[model samples]
Target: MTTIKASCPSCGDVELTPHQVRLVVCSVKSWSYYAFICTTCHEEVRKPAGRDVVALLISGGVVAEPWNVPAEVLEEHEGPTLNYDDVLDFALWLEQADLLAAAAAAQGPRPRAQAPETAA
Candidate 1:
């Protein structure tokens, strides 16, 4: 597996994992590329759409400063607020719940016990 090292754009920490980063980078843009999702904070280190990156990072606990970064930089990592572990745990819980629901549905409604035939 390939390994890549980079800083968490949200936290300014230089330890983003390869898995945490995505490479859907902007080719023409002169700004830093190499997208990443913070594992500890789940802050999108790239453009996530909706709210600003700083806001999202603040909400997700990715960075300490909510207003330190540039406005444009802050306007990037926007998405649902969630840390990596939270995301994973929630996903697992949802998956288990769905499985249980599916199993219950497949079992269908409970059937009433049939009366035994009387001897003639």
Candidate 2:
């Protein structure tokens, strides 16, 4: 069994086995991280795992877990932030709005058919 060395904020240094370490490699590079429980304080410690650290841990028998975050979750939007009152207003409006009727109204009135010209 391999002994892995990790540091805890409260406990300083602690030893861990490969099984005791959790390595997560995220789809987003900066989100990759490793976590372990400190032996002395029994507190869970988590740290960012860069490429080099990830490779080292994997080489030492630690299994890497994959985290795939959706792109939409990270997108930037330009708009006014919605507040609780805005959400409540929309919910209230939804309850009374006739969605089907509104959709029909949006299409506007159909063009009137022209009467056939009377024969001379």
Candidate 3:
């Protein structure tokens, strides 16, 4: 069978079959890329490929590898926007301890003031 020839940046053009090239598709990119170890220099080479190149590579029998991007990228932020004052408040709160106790210490334990008895 006739073998396809590919040129390696590190090494000159070498004879290899289509299956020898590795094609990777990343979800974040509209294009795909390929990596192949040069038979001449034994070094790996990677290059980006457009749709046409991708089709050609697949048609030529290159192995396909797929990768997915993180789902958090699509998630929306519904919480309130933070400002400098808000950040300062949060930092101060973090530095404090026993919030309930601090509140109680500030206000001595005392029964709620009762309304004066109303005369009929």
Which numbered prediction scores highest in TM-score against the true structure? Answer: 2
Q: Kindly list the per-residue Cα lDDT of model 1 for residues 2-107, writing each as its tens digit.
A: 3444456566655643445444312223332345666667767664322343344334434321123345754656678788999899999999999999999998
Lowest-lDDT window of 10 residues in candidate 2?
A: 95-104
**Which candidate, 1 or 3, has the higher lDDT?**
3
Tell me how candidate 2 scores on lDDT. 0.95
Q: RMSD to native for every prediction?
A: 17.2, 5.9, 9.3
Give lDDT per model, in order.
Answer: 0.54, 0.95, 0.80
Which residue ranges in model 2 land beyond 4 Å of their true spot?
Answer: 91-120
| Native-referenced Cα lDDT, model 3 | 0.80
Residue-pair clash count for candidate 2: 0
Q: Predictions ranked by TM-score, top down?
A: 2, 3, 1
The parts of candidate 3 lying over 4 Å away from their true place are 72-120
Query: 17 in model 1: Cα distance from truth in Å?
Result: 5.1
Q: lDDT tens string, model 2, 1-120?
A: 899999999979899999999999999989999999888888899999999999999999999999999989899999999999999999988866878678889999999999999999
lDDT of 2 at 91: 92
Q: Which candidate order results from sorting by lDDT in descending order?
A: 2, 3, 1
Winner on lDDT (1 vs 2): 2
| Model 1, TM vs. native | 0.27
